[model samples]
Target: MARHLRAFLGADDATLARRLTAAGTVQAVLDAIRTRLSEPARDALVAELTAATGGLLEEDLDSILLSGLLGYHGLVDAARQTAAEQDMTNLVTLDHHLVRVTSEPVVEVLVDRQQAYELRLALTVTFTVQGLAATVRAGRLVHVRIGRCSADVSLSWAGQALVRHSDLVDAPLVIKLGSGVPVHEITDPADDPALARGTARVPGPRVAQPGS
Candidate 1:
């Protein structure tokens, strides 16, 4: 299970997390994010706000109010981006050191499936489903065995099947496998095929600050 624990760090992941977490309330974080928007974005937001308020917009808008609206907009954009990443089956972040959502989705799905398998295995070990079962053993999902009472006898043999799926694989060296393994890689849309895709897109995470 420890091996399964992985984290992804895009640009400002630490700072963004800290800012968001340290805030006393969610509203505070939203306000901080509003000030980070570009001038054009800010003006557009103001215009949008004016339209929503039906021309009675305050001559002097409250900064906190304005930021609350802007922060909502930013969160909306972030959600859209997250959805796009899922649709693309990729989450490309700048830091190569951290596991990209793109890279981990496949493995994550595999680990999740194990939970399902564990439930089925429990039924197989006992004729009746009673009590609780733990999928992980000794901080590792491998060789997981679980049962209580009569089920314990069956688990001794049946629960040995669960094991962690390995992510490693050989490409340049293969034996009777499919050719051109497709070396799945990420690239920004702006990057040309001839150029390294890695060099094209910048990665950064959003950080909101406390209310100004």
Candidate 2:
């Protein structure tokens, strides 16, 4: 389920909603069956679930969330860049801890050759990273690591049904850290001098830029 979700991260609004619904449906059935089984029987199904997901059920939650966050950032950067070139407003915010990101995309579409209306869309992805840790340098957060993660996703399109999920449900999942995974760099020291010194370790969550 995590593997499919990772692919859906970069998909269009409609496609994402469709896939999430499908995955959620499958997960519901699997969950019902597992709950009725004995403890040992339930435990044995772990291997089956792993096989069914091609091992993605056991994949690192940190890596999946990081990829999604990075992709989210890239989208925001692209949108802002385009807005700057076109002299338009781009309303996008990623929180300081990088745990939540919201984007409001406003585009003008012509109803005919003579009239047009602005179409506004919204998307938000929020994550709660359990046991999150941080590295601070020069008064700025520079790196992070995670123990586990759960997510909330919502996407809305003008004149269309809204899609939201507290977590992906295709199968019962336990999101945890992968062995030997390294801390992720959230900021580059070379990009900002303030991020280069005064190193300290701390605990926290992550994502955002000022005036953006």
- Backbone clash count for every predicted candidate, in the order shown: 0, 7
Backbone clashes in model 2, listed as residue pairs: 27-170, 97-206, 97-207, 98-206, 98-207, 99-206, 138-197
Give a tens-digit lDDT track for model 2, residues 1-212. 44443343434434443443454522432343333544454333333322222211222334345444444443345344543454433333333334665545333222113212233445556676555443323222234444455577554554343455566432323334322122233322112323111111111112247876
Top TM-score model: 2
Q: What TM-score does structure 2 among the candidates reach?
A: 0.34
What CA RMSD would you report for each candidate? 26.5, 22.6
TM-scores for every predicted model: 0.13, 0.34
Candidate 1 TM-score, C-alpha based: 0.13
* Candidate 1 lDDT over residue span 1-212, tens digit each: 11111111111334323322333222332253433545554443333322221111111111111122222222234334544453322211111111111110000001112211111111011111112121211211111111211111110113342111222211111112122111112122113322111110111233568883
Q: lDDT per prediction?
A: 0.21, 0.38
- Which regions of candidate 2 deviate over 4 angstroms? 1-6, 9-98, 111-115, 158-161, 165-212
Residue 135 displacement in candidate 1 (angstroms): 32
lDDT of 1 at 197: 16
Model 2 C-alpha lDDT versus the unseen true structure: 0.38
